[model samples]
Target: MTAQAARHHAEGRLAEAVTAYTDALRLDRRNPALLSGFGLVLRDLGQIDGAATCFEAAFALDPGCVDAADSLGTLRAGQGRFAEAEACHRAALVHCADRAPFWNNLANALSRQGRAAAALAAWRRAVLLDPALPEALSNLGGGLCDAERLDEAERTHRRALRLMPDEPQANNNFGHALQARLRHAEAARWFRRALALDPGYAAALCNLGLAVQRLGDGTLAERLYGRALRATPDLPLARFNRGLLRLERGDLAEGWAGYGWRFASGQAGGTRPPRLPAWRGEDLAGKRLLVWGEQGVGDTILFSSLCGEAIARARSVVIETDRRLVPLFARSFPAALVRPHGPGAAAVPDCDLHTPIGSLARVFRRDLSAFPGPAGGWLVPDPARVALWRERVATLGPGLRVGIGWRSALVTESRRAAYSRLDQWGALFAVPGVVFVTLQHGACEAERVAAEDLFGVAIHRWDDLDLTDDFDGTAALMANLDLVIAPATAVGELAAALGVPVWRFGGRDWTQLGTAVRPWFPAQRLFQPQGGEDTPGVLRRMAGQLDSRLI
Candidate 1:
């Protein structure tokens, strides 16, 4: 209330203003104006505790003070005392129910309590009271995002930006909503705007990192994530993004350890639902470990290679794999127990160590040279299935039986995106004295029709020989083939595990193991893209390799 204190506060000299206000408050302890002025100066100076004390004293002197109550509630929210903040907001609302800022504060307090529906309703009321409440609209968008209503969330955020074009929080929130909708390009644009507004905005930087990662720029993503970490070290999203980048670059040892932070982050790319607890650097020696399968059946088949190595160290190993694979894997690993997949009467016993099938490779994996070629075939053919497959192969023809598969696995986004073009198989079928047999499963109707059109009688499509639908049947048929040529897939792995001669056709930038001949499977050879539109050329080369070796 003093002229000197007011002048200092107006000049943005908050520390000086606080000292002058404190002296004036000391002179007249009962003056509400002096106490409230001191509290505002203290709050600006970041002395939250002192500010709260001053606000409470001012409110005691004048019981109907709105600013004092609002400041006190904000301090409580900062301290993470949501219940106390809610009480303060509600009391302030009783005095001034129609105030837009008070309603926004109340909604924020409700949101902190995890009452998202009530928070949304309060935010709607706040916006109705003041249409220009950009912060309120942004908060509403956040609530909608929490509810997983991404489209509406995007619209709300855009509306906020339209009202306050340069609002930092609005830009950040809009970017986040766009990213949620998988609009990576647009999200990157909004995130850049947010960064331009405030260069050290940690959340915006982290979101930009994720968007760029989706755009397939891992190096830039890593740099952005690192910058976010420097700005806010405790941001779990940035930490998890850094971990994923490391994992993608094949730094599995540190990657798995950094990946443990996903549990702490409530991000979308965090760990999927697991049937068993994830292995957390727990000592597995002398402990019964249940390695439960997650994701698709082929992933289970690919990961099963690690079971033998893991079982060597553990007291006992119990594998809970896909039901279709039980007959095959059980025969291969007689030492370890096998349980069929899905719900059963069997109680999941409390095991000292449990790991998802995917994580096993990280712990007990070897380099390409050291890969222990699974003896014989882990996926054994059933007698009846073999009989059925033999009948189908005989019906196809008398030419050199060349098994051809083009599609990759179709479980996760990564797998679905890794398919080999069908034209890649055309040149191999065009080769002399070779018959193209369709070995792929989950081929689209369009792909199947196209295969028939391209290869004619040389291409055989048997509905009964689906690798995904019946693994045992496919294994039996693969066992009878002269040569198996396919994309770097689970079936390719399975064929090699069977010790059958296979030529793997790879994408231009495929797995490193697929680029070179795998020593683990001496029976296998790799034919990668020589560069551009040359899948046909890769296939022609593989046909030559097969003609020289097998013919």
Candidate 2:
């Protein structure tokens, strides 16, 4: 009967195997081999609890049942119980210390727990134990990629692919390694290979969408996200990426709904435990609500536009924002208590509900109609400092004061194209009767000097003002400017928020909320390189506009 049950399972007759195993187990309840075999049948049938019970019984019946323990450990790993899975795998490894699969299992659990160094060592040991093990090789390649040993990762992944040519996961993982190296086109091909192997593979579909997104096809990327969601409805990554697409295109309705999936998709901002339940668009009537800042400084400023709406609805509001923005925010929202966030955050009064600043859009800015503002922007700058800058700017002679930020301080590989080089701003600088001032943050003295030498136009910079840390000072200075020209970065956002006329550029800003201008700031105008137009061409066009419109 046991042999028949094993034969049924081996032939892929899972239902028949389950029945055979039940009949065999009824005959010999104390038999560890029978119990262990029964556990496999149950596990394959999706009866996880029953399978666990069978494995436990088998191990109890015979303490030497390493297979039963290993099976149980795999079940634990599948349930997202990594620590328990690690414990179970370790127990199995004690008796079967030489087993490559046991080490691989242990390594997988450790990897999930974010113990990268230990996981790498375990994967190496597993590969050393059995150099031909495809799973170990694939996992080791991923570890190498995480450690940024791209060359080693590519070699390891190539070997894994050679060993398991038909494995979709191996192909997908190799594509991930390529994507990490910014080889999106090559990565897309590997993702396609993975998709060809398994049409319903959700992960590969999401990865393919990311590659397409990097190639600048937001429409196709969104469609791929839809496909991935269709493949796996609960996939957080697809949902999160789709949300970003919708938001960027000014589809606030669906975008905000999808944006909430960011935390679940393993995007940052979930590090600190919540003191209160997440506020999911619930009515704040009489409820003390906390709106916390997230993402970057620009994001915090942009999202704070919705804080006014939050204040109107909630009984009281406590805003926790970037430390530098505290003074500016405190003056802007005088009704609410404003505090700086991050380590050593000041004592915030208890709140009934809490939400990240980004999440406020899902409730307040559901549509363009929800974005009605007082105009001139929401944030307020210090009147005294504004007067101080006004006097200082008067000394620069009779010309339109234009603050310029050429690039962001936090430019990553993906964001490289979003910002322009200092030389690209030469066309705008060459415009007559324009006093170009440096609002460019971080260290850019070389670029400033080079710009002056290249274009023979001086970009006036303040030696006293700290552009990076002093937001209140920056706000005051920006308030005195006649106009601000920059990318879709902090300077643009801040100037616009201060009600200063800003000519902002870069790409399709989703913050426009599907309009000709940014709804969050009525004082701003957007510019982008149309068709095949490059950065300098766009800047030249902007100069023409400045001459006719403002000069």
Candidate 3:
């Protein structure tokens, strides 16, 4: 009977195996091996409760049943009960301490529980027990990468590849390590290798699409995303990437629809409020609406423009935003109550419907024509602060006062390559009657000194204001400037929102939909490097434009 049950299980007939195993268990109810085999069959048949009972009985009958303990641990881990899984794995390891599979499973559970150091130790033990375990080596490589030991991770991944050259997971993980190091071209090759091993691998396809996108092939990346979605229809990462690609191409309708998947994809921060229903373009004649901010400060400022439209429909509105922007948002939207996000803000005020600030685009700005004009500036800076800044600016001797921001707060390699270098501002500095004031926040003393020494010009700095933490003060300072010349940072966004003239420098094909200007901010001018020209060339062109304007 046991042989027949084993045959059924081996043949992949889970239901037949369960029936035969039950008959065999009835004959020898107290046999630990029989009970463990029955538990395995039950687990395969999807009877989780029955399988757990059989495993527990088998363990009670004979605590030495290592297979029963290992199986139970795997089941618990799959069910997200990592602590119970760890206990089961530890029991199995007590009997077979040298077992590679037992140590590997223990490592997986520990890693899922966010115990990275312990997980690394367990993984190392597994590899030491069996040096040929490719999966363990791959996981150890991933752990090393997470610890920022990039060189060791690369070597470990190479070892795994040598052992199992055609392993899809190892290939994909190796590609990820390479991608983290910004070797996109090499990463794409490994991703392709993974796809070759298993063509239906949705994760590899999505990763390859990102690699190609970074390599400046948006069209191909879009096609890969489409393939990934077709293979795995509910993949959030693929959907989110598709949405970004569509938006970049100016397909607003499809773009906004895909953009709504950001929260589900975990690309956007914060979970949706549990009790409040999401707003879906319904008429809110007498209901209170909550509009909460998501993403960065620049994104919040950009999306705040839609509040006026929301105000026109809802009877009352409440805005929850970053702490720094509370004063500015409250004064700008006096009709609505404004609060900073924190502990008490989690329990939202009485509201009929709630929506993320970015989600408002789907309801209001469905197309390019739906955007408001240059007169649509909704942010109102404090008049007193504006007056104070105006008086301070009067002491700088009457030239064209320009606020310059050349760096972003979150500096990445891609941003560094895209933004204008401090030395590149030589041409702009040489422009007569143009006085440059530093609007950039953070540790700029080194860069400022270098720029001044290199360009032989003084870039004025104000020591009294905390530009990064004080949005209202920043807005007031922006209000007093004649023009702002900056990269596509938050400063540019703030200046454009305040109706100040801004020249935003960017990389090739960065301006959305190939347009020379962004429809969201009509007061801002978009400048891209022309004819293989670098940052210096772009700055020279901007200087020439300023010269013509001054003349």
Candidate 4:
């Protein structure tokens, strides 16, 4: 090749190099060297089929042309023809048995085909052959990350970064490992650096958004998601996050449709069993609909109320719910069939239509004005369970049967927004003539310990309440309570559904559309932070409300 063609190829000016290589090949049509050079240039230009043709022509003339074989293999790998790529790589290995790049390319093909063990071994061989192969190191780290060996993945990422400190993939991989460790701030910093190194780094941008969202700065998170979408509109997770923000804002039209990407984008997994088809917009007239639970117990209870509404749109309704609440829901929605959720949970195939219990609101939800008021009393406390609870509460003395919950699930890392400190709960604890009963589980171990340590008064304990921490327990407890005070979770929803009086503490920026007074739950009262999430003020208000309600 001419010096000009070589310079163009070296500078990554693939189109110019392709033109020059084509000109040289046309003059020496039968020259295997010229044909091989032309193929490499075509491959660099992303003209993979053309590159394969040129590589075939070169290999036909010189059967042992390992470069031509390797190029063809790499092209086939990019096209997802893993078997063909493996054949070409093996052929190239016969001629050049120690080529690390060829081995790395073979590993890439193997990893794509779900042969991760073989991929790791091949990658180890490539790294052994060429210790400076940063690409091989990075790919190996990703494979380890997929296998959940996060410590090994972290070490491998650091190794790749040492070779190339600004490598976007290495930085992104390191961020992922940090995120798995719950080091959101550190993860966000790494992802930001990756984005700075490659401004169009879509994966880095998405990770940064997720990290910030975990940190409870939805404003910054939304901006990062927008930036990612600007860089790549088709990035599904970015679209999904944007949709979540919109949904949170109550912009249902665009939000619900964008929300559909979770299942379609391969994010929400366990791939909804194929035996049950998704409820596409089809005819539901006179058909039985089986609405089943898919997420947490609280989410199940909060959304299950919509099942009766869904039944209004179908011929018959059947519900599959968490086993803890199956008896309760069966008793409540007797018009519809109800079953406890379990392995091989039978779906009423007799139902022509089906939707997740959560999706009922998506299909039939109405405007705020139309949010059906508390319908059936699905959450009645079992007479037996309530009697046991009464006996338990009676032991604490009947100042007032005040149930308390101060923690949410561990689904997100934003703890400060979800739960005020134990001292915040002191507002009600100090209130005269009230017994503080613990209903929350998990994370509160510290709070519980501190409360007992700080104050000699041991608050009433019912840790064995068998309450599933879902709204059902809340429902049963609310029915027996003088008043309920809890964080913004499914319990709050349960209290609302039961039309039982509750004091709800919420984040500062909760949707203004749903004011502190919720119409859906007539007895529900919301208490938000006055200045900057004043937990004391929320408790003080709850104490005052309880004093007024009882006296």
Identify the leading candidate in terms of lDDT.
2
**Model 1 TM-score relative to the real fold:** 0.61
Per-prediction CA RMSD (Å): 8.7, 4.6, 4.2, 7.5
For candidate 2, the per-residue lDDT at 123 reads: 94
Candidate 3, 422-453: lDDT as tens digits: 87788788888988898998777789999999
Candidate 1 per-residue C-alpha lDDT over 159-188 given as tens digits, one digit per residue, 9 for 90 to 100: 899998887778999988877777889999
Superpose all Cα atoms of candidate 2 onto the true structure and report the RMSD in Å to 1 decimal: 4.6
Clashes of 2: 0
Clashing pairs in 4: none
Report the lDDT tens digits of candidate 2 across residue range 394-443.
89998888999989997754466788899887678777889988999988
Error of 2 at 470 (Å): 2.5
Candidate 1 vs candidate 4: which has greater TM-score?
4
| Global lDDT scores for all candidate models | 0.74, 0.87, 0.86, 0.72
Off by over 4 Å in 3: 1-11, 20-156, 180-182, 215-217, 270-274, 508-514
lDDT of 2 at 30: 90
Off by over 4 Å in 1: 1-189, 198-207, 210-220, 230-240, 248-250, 259-283, 343-347, 366-370, 373-378, 408-417, 420-425, 443-446, 465-467, 483-485, 488-490, 496-551
Model 1, residue 142: C-alpha shift (Å)? 12
